[model samples]
Target: MGWMRRAKVARDDPDSTGATNTVNEHQINNEGQRSNINSLPNELLLLVFYDAIQSHDNCSAVLAVTCRRWRNIVIHEPKFWGSILLGSCHPLGKYRLWTMRIGTHSPPRRISLIIRGGPSVYIEPEWIQLFDALKARTYTIQSFHFHGNSESLSWANLRMGGFLCEEIYLHLDDRLSMNSSISAALSEPTWPTPYPPPLENSISPKILSFRQA
Candidate 1:
């Protein structure tokens, strides 16, 4: 529910960085004086966008839809899209549009993805396309969180041999399902042999916390 609420609360804020900018609020909005918020320098605007995005993972759409200038900046800035929130029930058309807008302009980089899926829901083609696209980013994924039943979790095509991800959280319907999924993943030749790299200290503690419904 928190994840869903995040998507809902993300609104386009024209003045995302209220007091952080050198420009004062009055100067930003002087009565009777025409003021174009887009007039801010590109560097400053990017800072604002980054801050907003960091604060709210769902702010990508809000930033892109703010105005043409901001939209262009958001589309071209790979850093602004480092974090992505994917939900199974989220409209595919809308998600596809946003991903295309953000991904086409720059070379893919590491991403922090928070994905929500469930066994009861059908996976959309767009979801598959999205996963493939992210996979093509190579080993740059820094973190991945999957919340779903075994059936839905299996749909996550994370077969790349190596990952830069330091955090991996798998929340599943039960321990049995989780074990089966891990076994299946490990059996895949493309997966790292040791699975999470046997020596990685951070992984053991975090992985043991996997949720069981």
Candidate 2:
């Protein structure tokens, strides 16, 4: 995830030369000699990160760039990345790279790992591809939340599969028919979709919350 630093540098200084800021292994200890955060043990550091990033979709990337020590900690501990954001404005490559942190053999989640789509969601192929690439509940999600317009969901092609999910929550705008929206979301057995035909290998979830806001 050290690559995130380069990505940040490139984004902040897009027109400049392509060279990225090199990571300093001693940066944390050297730069913040008097900082309390610097004194916390590795166990405490994990607790701090979990609390700081539970609401963030890109916790791993954000924490990785803080320092080499923190980056190494996040890379080895996958649970820190359980909460992921969807339909984000970040480039598709970044999302694809993010998925590399999750795998089948990873640790069991005490609670559901969430994937949420914000109001900023674009609902295009890029968004669809992002969800499709998630694999499903077993290799990926356990809970889901989406907030966007109905027309946007018309383009969704999610294929739900893998392990059963605990919940599916959607908050959609009232511009289109509710049936259209739910059909799209319930299409795939594991992935998100608007209105695709029923398929095999699916599990029933607890609830589907559809609200107009």
Candidate 3:
């Protein structure tokens, strides 16, 4: 009878062990929620950061400066630095930094660079700098897009030295047809061989030409 009464008390009293267990469980859950972000597993952290980056192209640069951990992640990961677009809006000061970051990849990954130019675009120097800076990286240029004036025709030839690019897009102004030297260069056996520039606009043609090698 005594043993039976003791068992009944234990079962019926919720304040004895049940309440303590519930409180402990709640505390455990709260601690988990308050855990430090840096305490997260490296793999999971990488996935979270990569998701942010893939969602927005510029997020790669943004996330790199958030904290030391994220910066390290961006620096070590080659995929983040694989593609570079130097448009008219991008600041020229950051170009060297961007190229250097991409240069860190071993056997360097395939890269795509788009250089936006206009009539007075002085991108020949930019191209020379990029080519020189990336030489040691041994980077493989997959595609290069240039948009600028006819004056660049002669100077831009420097970009073709060691470029094993798969595709090249040159959006040069129509004056290229008038200059005999530029016209002759474009007619060479290896130059614009397969892809011919469109002749739609005769006066000041904006030639959106492409060559696949």
Candidate 4:
């Protein structure tokens, strides 16, 4: 009887010990996961946040409000504010914020405004307002590329004031196809005078295209 009882005790001991070991292993794994999450650097975290924001505007705005650190990083990042690629669904308000948020650094060197899909109603006044605002700034904007329905093109605004742009490319739908529109807009008579010719011997054009966009 003594030997039989000892055998039963030995068998129960292994089962109890195995259960404890399993619990311990689980706890260790949880702790390790927490530690790895905490170890990620702030820069890495910021990049993760940027990726999250790029896909959806609502998410971006929400993330921007997550904390002061996130807000500051997103606001100061030049890429966030410099150039905006617009699609057919125009979010004018967002564009306004994007433009306003740009750093004091001169306007972006390249501006690509693409409007795709079938033609939409063209509201001349809003386009005029936006173009006028662009003209009012003193900074030299190098290029403006537009792609979309020709009728939607705001020719009046594009032709307004002096745009310090070196190269302007307009790709339009078949309806308003006219290469002359590009020339006419660039040839506005009242265009602002370009900055004084570079000192008698400047090697670069007042504005040069460093890269093709």
Q: Distance (Å) between predicted and true CA of 185, model 3?
A: 26
Q: Per lDDT, what order, best first?
A: 2, 3, 1, 4
Instruction: Please estimate how well model 1 matches the true structure, expressed as its whole-model Cα lDDT.
Output: 0.52
Clashing residue pairs in candidate 1, if any? none
TM-score result, candidate 4: 0.44
State each model's CA lDDT, in order.
Answer: 0.52, 0.54, 0.52, 0.51
| Candidate 3 lDDT over residue span 81-140, tens digit each | 655555544434455667667665543233334444554455455556555565444445
Say which candidate scores most in lDDT.
Answer: 2
Candidate 4 lDDT over 10-127, as tens digits, reads 5678766655555567668978986785477778866786676555434544556766766777777655544455544444555576666775655445555655443232454455
| Model 1 C-alpha lDDT per residue in residues 81-194, reported as the tens digit of each score | 766666644535554565565564443332334455454344456666666555465334455665665555444534322333554566565455334444222222232222
lDDT of 4 at 198: 22
Name the TM-score of candidate 1: 0.48
lDDT of 4: 0.51
| Model 3 C-alpha lDDT versus the unseen true structure | 0.52
Model 1 alpha-carbon drift over 4 Å, by segment: 1-39, 89-123, 132-139, 157-164, 170-213
Show model 2 residue runs off by greater than 4 Å.
1-34, 107-125, 135-140, 157-164, 175-201
